[model samples]
Target chain A: MEKSTNIIDCTIRDGGLVNNWDFSVEFVQDLYEGLSAAGVEYMEIGYKNSARLLNATEPNPWRFLDDHFLKEIIPEKKFTKLSALVDIGRVDPNDVLPREESVLDMIRVACYIREVDKGLELVQMFHDLGYETSLNIMALSSVPEHQLIEAFDMVKKSPVDVVYIVDSFGSLDPKDIEHQVNKFKDMLPNKQLGIHTHNNMQLAFANTLTAMRNGVTFLDSSVYGMGRAAGNCNTELLVSYIQKASYEMKPVLGVIEKHMLEMREKWEWGYIIPYMISGVLNEHPRVAMAYRASDERDNFVDFYEKVTSPESTIAPASK
Target chain B: MEKSTNIIDCTIRDGGLVNNWDFSVEFVQDLYEGLSAAGVEYMEIGYKNSARLLNATEPNPWRFLDDHFLKEIIPEKKFTKLSALVDIGRVDPNDVLPREESVLDMIRVACYIREVDKGLELVQMFHDLGYETSLNIMALSSVPEHQLIEAFDMVKKSPVDVVYIVDSFGSLDPKDIEHQVNKFKDMLPNKQLGIHTHNNMQLAFANTLTAMRNGVTFLDSSVYGMGRAAGNCNTELLVSYIQKASYEMKPVLGVIEKHMLEMREKWEWGYIIPYMISGVLNEHPRVAMAYRASDERDNFVDFYEKVTSPESTIAPASK
Candidate 1:
């Protein structure tokens, strides 16, 4: 096992998308304690985006992620470090507290290739605030190679501790992951690399293993694969498969038992056909997610026809 | 798109394990037509074993696969060829008809490593009957390399047209498939290779593609992945993903819509967690399948504990 290899549990942050960040605090607390016990290096509890900037009427604690609330919910910090994600335009710099005052040890900036500069700016601010930072470039499957190179140029000079290869659409196979990892290694030789994969094509765990084998240091997974459309790489699988001395599979399985199994019933996720088709076509899963929510959920052929028709662009539905 | 690559639809034969060969004649006929239209080279319609030899009282057309019944069901043969599987001792030599008198173009012999000689004897008989023969060695993941190499020496001299690498437990990943294909190639240089995969770890499609890319010719799949446990690689995925001019996705989807979707609800198959765990551990799914049948079906952690306990050997349940 690589000494620098770290597992980041993002169940609350990524899974919150499926249920509007409505997870109970008890579930969140249980997950934090479980992840710490499992010897996971980091736990991303939720997003730290500014609700006022997005003009949201409803106040969800996980969506906004107040430092005071986090401290109250998790009074004791265990071995696992805490992190949160922030979108380029959604988070306000003024709203973030310094690392010494807040429980969060890391702030991850997730952005499209076009927003790399803005994303790096946030990374610089978080770095100046005495926090570890990572820049997660979303939707690597759809990004043109030249644009990725251009983004890496800015990233290589930035204070971002890690640059992630994000398979936002769950579209990549191990072959593709290998190619991307090599590209990132070549472009950003000074920085460590991370991997965040989705299960659309049922390749999440395999792809993550491929990345790990190719020298990726940071791995992002969720408990019981609870995330967006097809979910993420399973944390239990990662813990059990990775031959690290510190990692334990029992704690990961414990958290999954305590929360994710119930969440699975209420939320429709994992390797459904629609998500798979979207993945094979190398498209975002938002379209497939919408189709699954519609009345014709079981009508796979209809969904296939709609996505592959000559006139159909099958764009992501508006949020 | 290798010219030698062929798709074999095994819905009826493999899926019969789940539904006790109870498929309606109409469904079988439609599947035959759909597979033909989709340009699948062969379809394994049913088993060719003699029920009397196995001491069975009740007779089912599919389980017995009478030539007269097959002729009635598929009076007009289309582009696709027909095949049937038989166990080593379960099939009586006198029960088989010559190719001139039967609708089946191929007779596949499925057996364990210890039954190689017996299986080869059946293959020789089928070859003398003027039918294409394939030796399907089941449970290859559990077979030792030395045993497989020894079996292949006898198989190399036999008249079998294709030898299959069967992932009976759905336990293999693409990397494992690649290694197995190379080993098979090294051992049996003259015989064409086939791949039969289960979806226990949701790697069926990916593993099949890996084998195909590494020069395996015959690919086995089921409509909507309707087989035992987690089922087989979906025929629809293979047809749509394999970029051949003869392959058409709509026909495969049509059959799935007409028959498989309804079959899915009544009989559970595909990526359930217990099956996935079995696949990950490289264990036969009979244990997981038994767990699914018990009242504690949804208790994944309990199932995991039972299977992985130090005292639990988890041998397949006796039929």
Candidate 2:
């Protein structure tokens, strides 16, 4: 087996979006301890996107992690470094403090195709501030090949350590992942490639494995398939499946047993009728999400009529 | 879109294993009512495999589906027809009454590569006896290419109405399924093709979709991902996802709301750690099943140690 692969746990980050970041501090602390024991490399605590930007009135502890709040939750840093995500234009540069004072080791920047330059600007700032940084370009399935090339050219010149292939739509197959990996390796030979996948097509786990086999380094997974739409690949799946001798499985199991099971019960994601249909039809999950959240979701006849109607294809332009 | 693809609901047959076939007559009746409302073409009510052959002492009525019990449970045929599965030799020919008198419209035969002839023998008997028969060759993943070729030659000559690509291991990817579909179509050009996949690798939904898109007519799925091992492709997912205007979503949702939610609480099968691990490693779920069954399974470290040891790989010498 190859050397231990770096696992990035995204339960609190991606999963938080499912439940509007309602995770208790106790759950977060227990998750930290469990993930650390499982030998997870990095645990993405939550998005660092400013709550003011989204205009969300919800308690924003996880939405914007503060050094004071983090120190209280986790006093000791042993295994499992902490990470936070920032979207372009959403994060306030003033919110980021000295790296030594904060509990985080990495600050990930998520952006769109046209925002690569802005994303790298944050990466550069985080790099100078003494934090491990990565630039994740979202909605990769829809991005033209040349846009990625143009983006990667700038990313190659940046000080970022990791570049991710984010299958935001969960539309990529294994072959697509391999092609992306090869493209990333050829373009930026010096930087490591990470993969973030959704299970819309039920290919998240397989796609992640394909990337690992083809030499991609970082794997993003959640526990109990708890994330947006069909969810990300399960972290418990990765730790136990990698052939390395030192790959510990208990931490992952502990995370699932303690936090994930309950979290799944409370939240509705992964393998629902709409999500599965979206995956199978190779369409986006928006329609499925709409149908699921609708009152007549269980009424198949009505659901079918609405979906097949000419108006179903022509969604309202306002949203 | 293709004049309504036929759906075979295996909730009772496959899901029965997860709950030790403890389904009450009322639950089966409700499921039948629900499946019928959802426009399911056929519902496999039970398996006719002899319990004595497996030395299973459990009172698994579905394991050995008697005609009297079948009549008692689903007395009236509704919108969907009924079917039952039988293994070669284990199924008593005398046990199967004529289709006119019986509740079952079809009787399927499942066997290994070596038992194709036996499987077809049963298929011919059932066909002559006025039952829609299907030959389901199990473990298509393990079957060598040439063996499948030879088997298909005889199968093409048989009177069976349907041929199934039984992904018993859930190991095949879409490419594999596509290749298999092309091979099946080329070999048995006259027979209708069916797909039955496990969610061991989380590809059940995708694989089924691929088959449907590539011209296979029969699609087998269950409500709420309830089936053997990691479960089958979710029927709700299929109904909601299929682009066909005739596919209804409400009956599936009703099944989920009424039965599946409660069933999920009682039985643990969906996306658990062991199942996800099996999926990521591209391995069979035997270890996961063993681990889940054991009391010490939560100790992932110990389970990892036991499975990866060199001694575990050695096959025992036998006379």
Candidate 3:
């Protein structure tokens, strides 16, 4: 039954948040081939957000994935299909090509509960362009039950193929994940479900697995857990743990050797104490991320005191 | 309801395995006081194994855990009770004093399937001496169903206070934990259950929580997860996550600041790739531990190749 599960490797896309989507061509190419060899269903190469709409000057091919550039990078499609993510307001409808004309197969839209209608609009556009689409409802842990119920009304009627339960703070445990999955299943009986987790409490892989066992088909993970702040679930962990004959652990290990280990050293991510505190408190990791960036990074006691102080509402800028 | 759940902090005892039980007097003293202030139910100070029986020459107070030395270290016992673990053949009957005459409230026997009868003998002796006792069945992942069923026949008839579901290799997931807890509950209806997990797949905390939710009572953890290989679940994580009025997070954090952080730098533990591979394969971490100690520690690809090779069975000495 688990053989039908879809593993979506997001090494370049989610990890790009840590490195500002500044990955080398060689790393991305190798990652694509490695994920293909590992029998991962999908590889999320990068964000497809329009740079012009976001008022960005730099031409990062990964951040604003050009179909032609992607084709040039890998002329032949491997076993793994390609996907890209976009925020609600950043992507221009004019910028997206039809799936038949582009290298990308899936377009995932990530948005907050308040932006569900807008997210649905983007999903409709992507579906109309003949691409598979999923809507990731970010910060599900923070959303109220009534708000989520209201949001699901729009989602149930939308063109989205899969609905994701995103533990944005990495705050949720397996019990919480089970509750959310049950609620999602009850609300969206006609749609497939997905799970996107962060590793703040070191529960990302566990939570993802919990969701999968409870019938979530799509799993989002990264190699070496390389993402923002506490990072996401490690892709290799999923490939190795999931009991599917098609999945191979060696290729995932090879990719980690060629790229992830060096990238981990260059950038700071994964389970540090500050991130753990933030995840426990169910707060956004921006404050902890800022704390880690300062000279007092190792001053965990100070960080805890400041975060838990009754008078403190230290809101750091989000990544 | 969760207030009835017992938190057994095993920082010194489990972490001692990593550093050969060579903890300083001040470190152990501070840990005891910290755990007491944190309102933890129990603190496992060290092993109570007889050094003479094991043929050891060095006099490590923590390793041997003499009652007088333990009393000297914690002259005035506070909120937390004391416990110590012993191997099946390592402890002499005369070495253990009655609970009323000693600092230790509990004596836990750790053993493999083949040694269950011997472990039960030790458990009976400790119980007769008026001490709380648990039989920690080590390496439950590797133990066959029939073997565990056979072991439980002896456990159900014994004087053990709790029966532990120990994931010695850090291999099990929450689903696996749920099944094991259900099986334990079904087999030993009269005995309380405990969980001892490792962080190889970063599921230690989640697995423990899963067991607790499924009615497991005693939770084994170490401050900052300082045990052998990938370590145990973090004590702070359990203290913070468990919604018990008696649990305090600040003192746990203080102990982590004063000792565990430095200890982490001196020793290597927690979720490294080699340990994850071993956990995934359901193999004991001794091979992974040996790989980590060698000059080719960073050669993850080579390690994977060697471990997965059909002709290879690299068995290293177990801890």
Top candidate on TM-score is 3
Rank by TM-score (best first): 3, 1, 2
Q: Of the candidates shown, which would achieve the greatest lDDT relative to the real structure?
A: 3
TM-score of chain B of each: 0.97, 0.92, 0.97
lDDT of 3 at B30: 88
- State the TM-score of candidate 2 restricted to chain B: 0.92
The lDDT of each candidate is: 0.88, 0.81, 0.90
Ranking by lDDT: 3, 1, 2
Residues B1-319, candidate 2, lDDT per residue (tens digit)? 3565888999889888788788887788888988888778889988987777768787888778877888887777888998898987797777778888888899999999889999999999999889998999888887899999999989989999999999876767666898999999999999999999888767787788778878999999888778877999888767766666666777777777667777788887866656655554455666777788889655554555455566865211210
Worst 10 residues of 3 chain B by lDDT: B310-319
Local lDDT at A295 for model 2: 87
Q: After superposition, how far is residue B300 of candidate 2 from its true place, in Å?
A: 5.1
Worst-scoring 10-residue span by lDDT in model 3 chain A: A310-319
Candidate 3 residue-wise lDDT, A196-315, digit = tens: 999998899999998999999999999999988999999999999999998988888898877777888889899888899999999899899888889988887788889988777675
Candidate 3: residue A288 lDDT (0-100): 90
Candidate 1, residue A273: lDDT: 79
lDDT of 3 at A313: 66
